[model samples]
Target: MYIAFALVLLFIGAEGLVRGSSSLALRAGLSRLMVGLTIVAFGTSSPELVVSVEAALSNQGDISVGNVVGSNIFNIAVILGITALVCPIPVHRQVIKVDAPVALGVALLLVLLLFNQTLSRFEGVLLFSGIVAYTWMSFILARREASPASADNEDILAVTQSRHWGMDIAFILAGLAVLVVGSRLLVEHAVALAGSFGISEAVIGLTIVAAGTSMPELATSLVAAFRKQPDIAIGNIVGSNIFNVLGILGVASVISPMEAPGISALDYGVMIMFSVLLIPLLYTGRRLHRVEGGVLLALYFGYLFLLWPE
Candidate 1:
């Protein structure tokens, strides 16, 4: 019951956020794709941020790493796959050339760091700095490439329709509040339920907790797909994955230095494989088709198989 209720809040939050952020971006003369990659992406990734930070502070640093890796894997496999299944999502040119590949590189970086047996505070600083740089570069690009003329022309209609800065801010804040509450509820109840059933610890962490932290991404992407905003949908996924590695892990490591570090090599490989798989999937016909979505979903189930026995 709690899980169902949390899902409802997630949907409502995601809907409000998508409309608010997308509209705000459009009003600021930014394209939906750019807005998705920036504002929506950051907003939706907040749940992962919270989970990782808490795990780090509690000395359960492996959970921090697992949460991030697992969430990123889920974001690509389940979330993106489902979104594409709902509606074929167009791969923006910038995404193919820039964001998607950046995500791959970030995943690779995480794997390398894990193999080193520690994510030291210095390394954490480096990882955190990368996101800062990426966000700054993104803003500059958005300003230069966005079409202000569209916003100007739409302004009259927006005013007549009562869409303004105040309303956009309200939507964003309200969405954030709902997302935090929903994520917390879902994670708590899921962990409890899994424990009650004697489910494998690995399954609970990699599935329930990972999925819970990724609810915001799931919600935002699903909503974007439903609204026929393919660019925004894909952008939110790719961007959130990048933030998962660079932003969340970085912050978590800096906070606690992540001492519990035993991520399986196979698990790391799977994460990288999924990240790289996006390139070919998106490159083929320049969009994620339903068939590819099925393939991703299959790969995710395969990943779950690996975790189940471990």
Candidate 2:
């Protein structure tokens, strides 16, 4: 019952988070692409961020790593899968040329860091810095590309001033607070549920917990796809992947340096392979057609099959 309630809260909080953040971004004069890339991406990833922090503080480092890695896989395969099935996601050239490679690079870096059996404070700092730099660069590029014909910043400011920024901020804060508390409840119940079934925490995080947190991504991507805003949809996924790898893991490691568990290697391998497999679709004319979406979905199902207990 607690788990079910938490799931309900999670969905509600995610909806509020997305709408609130997107509205705030627009009110602040951000372009649609920038809103999609930064605000939307960060908002959708809040669940993963909260879960990873909680898992690290609780000393469940394996769950921390598993959550981020598994969420990324689900973000690409499942979220994008169902989104594409609804409406084909047209890949933007910038995503294919810039974002995809960066995501792949980050995945490889994660693998290399774990190869040494731990992600130290130094490595964490490096990863965190990379994330900051990437974000700064993305914002700069967005500003450069923004058209002069775009909506006036004064109009944006007027809209923001007309509304209660304080109220919106409060709503966002309250929603996030609820989400954090709810994530704890969900994770705790999930762990108990998994133990009763004699399932490993890693496996539970990989399947159930990962999928639960990824609901935001699934919802956002599907909505974006149906609206014919494929660039936003794809950008949201790519940005979330980067944040999951670098931001979530980096901060968690700094809080509690993760020692590579026995299961880490398999998880890392899957993450890298998944990122690699995306290269062709991302680069081929900068569009993920229905065929590419089908391939990605099939691969994800195959991965799930492999994860099942023998």
Candidate 3:
């Protein structure tokens, strides 16, 4: 019953968030792509940040670390795969040139810092700083690309003018709140279910909690794709992955240093593999085709199959 309710909430939340965030972008003369990369991405990733921070504070270091790593993997492998299958998503040059590399870079950095299985407060600060820098750069880029064609701007303006800024803000906030609540309920129940089967905390965090917390991204991205806003769809996945590693883990570690002995080199390798794979997959035809989507889905399920507890 709770699972069904959470799914409903997640769908509603994703719709409101995508609508409000996209409309806000139109009103501000910014591209929906930029809005997706920043606001929508951060909103969807909030569950990961919250779950990780709480786990860190509770001294569940394995869960905290595993959640971030696993979510990053799921975001690319599953979220993007499903979005692409819904409709072939066009890859923006900015994402190829800037965002994708940044995603890969941060993933590498995280692995390097985690070689000793420890994340210190100082390293956390460094990672946290990356998000601030990335956000600032995005805004700067948004300003440069704010001037969409006059006809496109006019059409967007007509559609958005009826909606007030206050309503847009309300939609974004309410959507985020609902998403977080729904994600929490799902994750709690999922962990309990997994624990009933004797799954370790680290494995539970990596497989169940990670996917549960990422439900928002999956919902929002699929909605964006359905709405024919492919930029938002793609950006939400890439941006969320970046935030999952740099922002979520950074904050969690800063609050309390994390020692993740249960997160093995294989987990980190898989995360990095997904990160690296996105570059060519996106760059190949400048669009992610259904076949490529199938490949991603296969790889992700294969990984999960191998990871499944005996």
Candidate 4:
């Protein structure tokens, strides 16, 4: 019963975090794409980030690593897969030309760092720095692209005028508070529940914990897809993938060095392969039609088949 309640609360908290943060971003004059890419994406991934960091600090390094890697796999293979199945996500040229490459590059960097089976603090810093630099560059590009003829500028100004800046800040702080508290409770209960069932920590991390932390991403992506905002749909996944690799892992490692479990090599290999596989679909000039969406969904199901418990 406690576990069930924890799950409910986890989802509720994630929903609150996403709603508050996305609203705040909109209120702060951010463009829809920027809101989706930065606020929505980061907001959705916050639960995973918090959980991974806490796991690292508590010395449950396997949980930390597994949570990040599993969530990324789930984000692309599961979330995107389901979204595509619902509605074909159109591939924007900007994402194909710019974002997909960055995602691939980061995945490669993660593999290289983990080659020795451990993530050190220095590598963490480098990864985090890269995220910061990428964010700065994104903002600069957005500003440059906003023209006198573009409606985005009007949208930004309207958002800025309608809401009090203080209220926006307050909502952000409150949302974060809820997220941290909710994550702590969920992780504690999840670990305890797994122990009761005699489940390996790694397995718990890979499945239950991973799924729990990914609730926000799942919800946000589903909502975006339903709204027919393909840009947001694609951007959310792309940005979350980057954050999972760089921000979540980076922060966790900095909190404490993480040692990968025996199965991690297999997991990492799969993650890299999936990350790479996404490149072609995203890079193709054409949109992700139903057939392509079907293929991606099939690949995701195959991944799950391989990981399912005996």
TM-score on alpha carbons, each prediction: 0.81, 0.90, 0.84, 0.87
Per-prediction CA RMSD (Å): 4.2, 3.3, 3.5, 3.1
lDDT of 2 by residue, 1-310 (tens): 8877777677777666766776777778776666667777877887887887788778776677788889989888888777777777777667777888999999998888877666787888888988898898889977876764224322221223227566567668777878888789878998898789887888878878788888888877776676665556788889999989888888878877776473456677887887887778767776677877887889888888888672
Off by over 4 Å in 1: 1-34, 147-202
Evaluated against the true structure, the overall lDDT of model 1 is 0.75
Ranked by TM-score, top first? 2, 4, 3, 1
Best by TM-score: 2
Error of 2 at 249 (Å): 1.2
Each prediction's whole-model lDDT (CA): 0.75, 0.77, 0.79, 0.73
Summing lDDT over every window of 10 consecutive residues in candidate 1, give the lowest-scoring window: 153-162
Ranking by lDDT: 3, 2, 1, 4
- Worst-scoring 10-residue span by lDDT in model 2: 153-162
Error of 3 at 134 (Å): 0.7
Cα lDDT tens digits for candidate 3, 230-306: 65667778888888888999898999998998887778999999989999999998999989988999999988887
Compared with the true structure, model 3 gives a TM-score of 0.84
lDDT of 1 at 300: 95
